[model samples]
Target: MTSAPITAADAAVTSDTITMPLEDVIDPDEFTPRLLALLSNALVYRESHELRRQFKLGTNEWRVISALSMRPGMSATEVCEFLGMNKAVVSRSVTRLQLRALIVLSDGPRGSRPLYLTRAGAEMHDRMLPVSLRGQEIITEGLGATEVAALNEVLRGMLARIRSDAALQGAPGSPSQYPID
Candidate 1:
């Protein structure tokens, strides 16, 4: 069965039928995609703010550290490809991380160097884990385990479908990079 068109007329009003103007009745919450995107940005901003205050790390740096923690010894280009970030941003974050002594570079063939987290970096990542997990807990506080699992499954399926369609279309520029599974 199809759902009714969401219109201003559906809103509650007096029995006399005075209603809100149509232009003013566009509820943002009804747009699932935009709502989800806004929610994602808000959550990211909150977590990033706390991470910076606690660890003096920007979102880019934390992304690099998190990526390296999972897959150690990734070259800068590999990091960019893996993270879907441009070369310049990743390079700058890598430089900052190196300056902070959180990452070390090891020489490879043809002047290529792979980045590895220093002992300090690993320790810092260990400390940051719980903070990230706690942010997740806060967001999912009202969701049951089954609901959480279903949400995850739906999101993953959507991502996979979009990625597959993009690949097939081969739309402009470089190919898109996906999150590590």
Candidate 2:
């Protein structure tokens, strides 16, 4: 990475332009994979904050509602796995939703209790559905149907690669098999 030319006009600049922003120095649309992931997470944070403010639901709570709405009945561990969220956060959210009368617990195989959304929870999901749908539309505004499908396929591949790495890390002797450079 090279620094911009320094001159009298640039002397007052204190920003680390040399290495601070790779996207800004290049075409803004061309982003590194790291930056793309960061931006995707940041967008989720922003959306979650807005939804929390508007609907009186925390991000995790909203996610629980959303997940149950889709999956009908899922354990906290299952929700955590599906959402790639921390177990504690999902557990707390499950408790909160239950206390709020938004969800109900039901017995499952092996004495497990899976969560299911109540009528109120379904109503909330109905109301918040537009927010996510519109957000998706905005995110893929300029893309054709084919392009959107391709993007989804590529994202799935990327997620699979990361999931494989996570699975490997959990296996015994895996780290020793592939030492970090």
Candidate 3:
């Protein structure tokens, strides 16, 4: 493995970049992964904040809702795989949705059962769809369609590459085993 050398602009004393919280000691610009992680955190925070206020659900729970809406008969284990989230997190979200009558579980394998959104759950998902779509638009507000497509392509490739990392193979809820591209 090789590490990319940091550019001078990343840590030059004369540069006027905002490297706050880490100062010149570390630059977020020096790390593409850090920048991407920050962007994801920002987007999830914004959406989750609004979701909690509007529907009493956080982004993780919302992800579960979205997953079930897209593929109604998925088991909790399948949902974990689909979302690349922990089993415990998915299980908690499943329990919360069930308690609220938003979804119901049907028989399947002894431990992993299929789950489906009830009529109310479907309604909630339909109502929440706009929030998710709006978040996407906001993030790409200035980008043209072509640029947006390019950005999406890059993101997909990056995700596929990261998911294919040998260290992640067979990890809990690992998507690494799947053919991403």
Candidate 4:
């Protein structure tokens, strides 16, 4: 999808009815949602690239590992809930991690299912946390502490709103279920 390009200066106009160059005024019918989608896609791509490079993990893999790190020995169901991921995706990630010797499965004493991270998994998590935090710090360094806090709050609110709306619309999944573009 293409949008009429609006320069930064053009976007700063104050008047509601300011006359823009022909190239700046995109057709509302065709441009608005597409432009929004383009921005969303770009952000997701950039974030994913950073995650892949810094952590050596895809977005899905990171989600699974992060969830396990937070609460070791959680069942797949627990992971799905905690990560807001689909069962299949979590299952695949777990399988991959197990194959990579990063996680392990055991039987509970009472014969119930067991879920957990291996020592290697814990070590990997510890190793990756600093890198992830550094990436986050880099991304937010331009913003003041208060601005960063506000940004977090705003993003959380938006996520909550979207989740609620999805639920009301009878969507099959939660906010995090959708792949990032």
| lDDT scores of the candidates, listed in order | 0.83, 0.77, 0.83, 0.73
Q: Candidate 4: TM-score? A: 0.65
Ordered by TM-score, highest first, the candidates read 3, 1, 2, 4
> Cα lDDT for residue 107, model 3?
88
Q: What is the per-residue lDDT of model 2 for residues 14-84, given as tens digits with 9 covering 90 to 100?
A: 67545355553555466667677676787678768777888877767887899898898788877776776
Off by over 4 Å in 3: 1-26, 109-111, 167-173, 176-181
Model 2 lDDT-worst window of ten = 172-181
Task: Please give, for residues 1-181, the per-residue lDDT of candidate 3 as tens digits.
Answer: 9988999766677567655565445565888889878988988889999899999988888899999988989998778788877789998998888998999999877776889999999999998888788889987999999999999899888777767664456544356333343
What lDDT would candidate 2 get against the real structure?
A: 0.77
TM-scores for every predicted model: 0.77, 0.72, 0.78, 0.65
Error of 4 at 39 (Å): 6.3
Off by over 4 Å in 2: 1-31, 169-181
Candidate 4 lDDT tens digits, 28-84:
668856775775576556656876787566667766777777787788877887777
* TM-score-better candidate, 1 vs 3: 3
lDDT comparing candidate 1 with the true structure: 0.83
Please identify model 1 stretches exceeding 4 Å from their true place: 1-27, 173-175, 178-180
Model 1 agreement with the true structure over 21-51: per-residue lDDT tens digits = 6666557879877887898788778778888
Candidate 2 vs candidate 3: which has greater TM-score?
A: 3
Residue 15 in candidate 3 has what lDDT?
67
Error of 1 at 20 (Å): 14
